[model samples]
Target: MALHSASVNSKLIFAPAGKESHGQAEQFTRGILTRSDLDQTSPIWQFHKWFAAAQRSELVAHPETCCLSTASLPSGRVSSRMVYLKELDAEGFVIYSNFGTSKKAQDLSTNPWASLTFWWEELERQIRVEGRASRLTREESQKYFDTRVRGSRIGAWSSRQSQVLKPIQGDAGDEEDDGRRVLDGWVKETEKRFEGEENIPVPDFWGGLRIIPESVEFWQGRQSRLHDRFIYEKKAPTEESVQEWTLERLSP
Candidate 1:
């Protein structure tokens, strides 16, 4: 079911926690979410708190990963992919990737809107973000690129992400092996070309995108299929410096 449907049925629907002979499900009573514990002044702070908690726990290996969804403007059919959330601020969530390369990036080009989901199964918590995707400044992109390892930085050049690869030419042991050799050649060449330079050239198409959230929702699983759902929606843009936001609990 959609999170914000006009039907006014905000209750969450989930199959019981298990696949049983009688289709019975396990109840999730692991955690409690209260408005008193969540800060209304800033949803970002609340998000940081939850994210920090997840990071500190041994249960999470990579808490920064989030699923990002985007659609082609004309078609409206959406596609989702896992991306690492590299940065977060009052502005919103940030992720870096090759622009105009992957299908998701193409979708974002046509339709700037995006939705992000961060689910920590161990914590039974999820955060959903709806926003517009906009490119980061060149300086911002370069700054992050500087922090990447040598091989990954070179990979940005060697890989034309989501692009179809050409069939390897000439006689070879096997097709897959030939393709691997071809890729390795590119990587080797890239490494050699940048060996002398202190700063390798960041791919012109590689950069970051910030999801400027229109709304952010936090969910916590509860017992008897009741989940805590709270959403913070931006009040709207104005001439003022600080944007206002409204927080409310959805019936779940």
Candidate 2:
């Protein structure tokens, strides 16, 4: 274990962290995991294995970060962005975003279906999740919102995220610097606006979305350009029983 520290609002926060690389790339052999090795009941459990491995591997940074892709219905316009996976359970995957600002949010509003991808390049593994996205309850959103860093919480309130930004006028020479100056000004203003205010409420337009998976596929790299692939697909719910899922191996 190793010790690490971070400063937030002039307060020091310390924690332990460590992940060491084992050997040279050339020395590491290709990974192999067939369907027999996969969890047959719940892909969520299978995800736990890969996720834990990624977290332990030195090459994996931000293992919880995944690509969330949403498509606008009929038009088929698709957009994707990296979002931190905040929660994962028997329910689904959870992430927070500005509900009204981002195109991805808008897309999900129109079409609930979404696709998520988690790629651990160093481990030669990728997991794809296809599911329907739904807004989390107000209480759930608030609970998680309270855990975010102060600046992030303020950001959810300030600077309309994903909105078209106005270009600065006049000769600032360096537009990038001028843009940052304006943003910093907004941050300061927001901080003051919330001064002495405890428990900054979650923004009405910002909250969490949970993806309810219907199908999930896991891929592992192997030799000779062949790969190991397995999928767990949710079966249709019967009137007498709840939702059930089945696992099957897929052609590489």
Candidate 3:
């Protein structure tokens, strides 16, 4: 086997030996199972094994974090990037980014629909989720943000993300002086904003987006091009009741 690099949003492409076309190789590579191989099981148990394996590997490798993609209104092109997955639960996957951030925040405003994919090569598995996202409560965001290290909290306050960085040349002392000034300004502003509370409040623009998964599909690779796949679909409630899901197998 031979591997090569192709610049597609900073992602790598691996090809087998003697493969002539990258596109053909990519299509072949993505030929995993469809939604027809799963057996009837509880939603949690249907893909328990694969999910556990993904979690274990993610803990160590943190494969590509989480990618957030959104389509702008009318006919604008879509944009995506790698963001950290903060938490995952029965509710859905949770991720935090500044509300002032461009792609995510804007998309969430117009369209709350999103998708998440997790790929684990060691396990030959992939999990994809599609869902609607909503903002987490202030209490939830504060609880998580407060647990971060002091330096991280300070950094969050000291820097403006997604903004251009101006070049400034100076000696070590001058740099130190600049940093101190910025830090001091942040400290004073924060103190005044929070009324001198020792526990810093979570920034209003920083919070979490909880994706309520409407569908989750799990795929596993097998030899001879025969693969296995299962998809779980969340059932809508007719009345004011809890949501339920139905599992279905898809054709490979």
Clashing residue pairs in candidate 1 (N, C-alpha, C atoms within 3 angstroms): 16-25, 17-26
Candidates sorted by lDDT, descending order? Answer: 1, 2, 3
> How far off is model 3, as Cα RMSD?
7.2
In TM-score terms, candidate 3 sits at 0.68
Clashes found in each candidate (C-alpha, N, C closer than 3 A): 2, 0, 5
Q: What is the TM-score of each candidate against the true structure?
A: 0.86, 0.82, 0.68
lDDT value, residue 101 of candidate 2: 76
Show pairs that collide, candidate 2: none
- Candidate 2's C-alpha runs over 4 A off are 1-29, 170-182, 238-240
Per-residue error for 133 in candidate 3, Å, reads 0.8
What's the CA error at residue 95 for candidate 2, in Å?
Answer: 1.0
Tens-digit lDDT track of model 2 for 1-252: 335554445444233222424332232145888778887778888898889889988789888889999999889998999999999988898999998878987797789999889988788889999999999988999999999888899998886777655546646675544455566667888899999887999988999999999999998877655778889999988798777788887887
Number of the candidate with higher lDDT, 1 or 3: 1
lDDT of each: 0.86, 0.84, 0.67
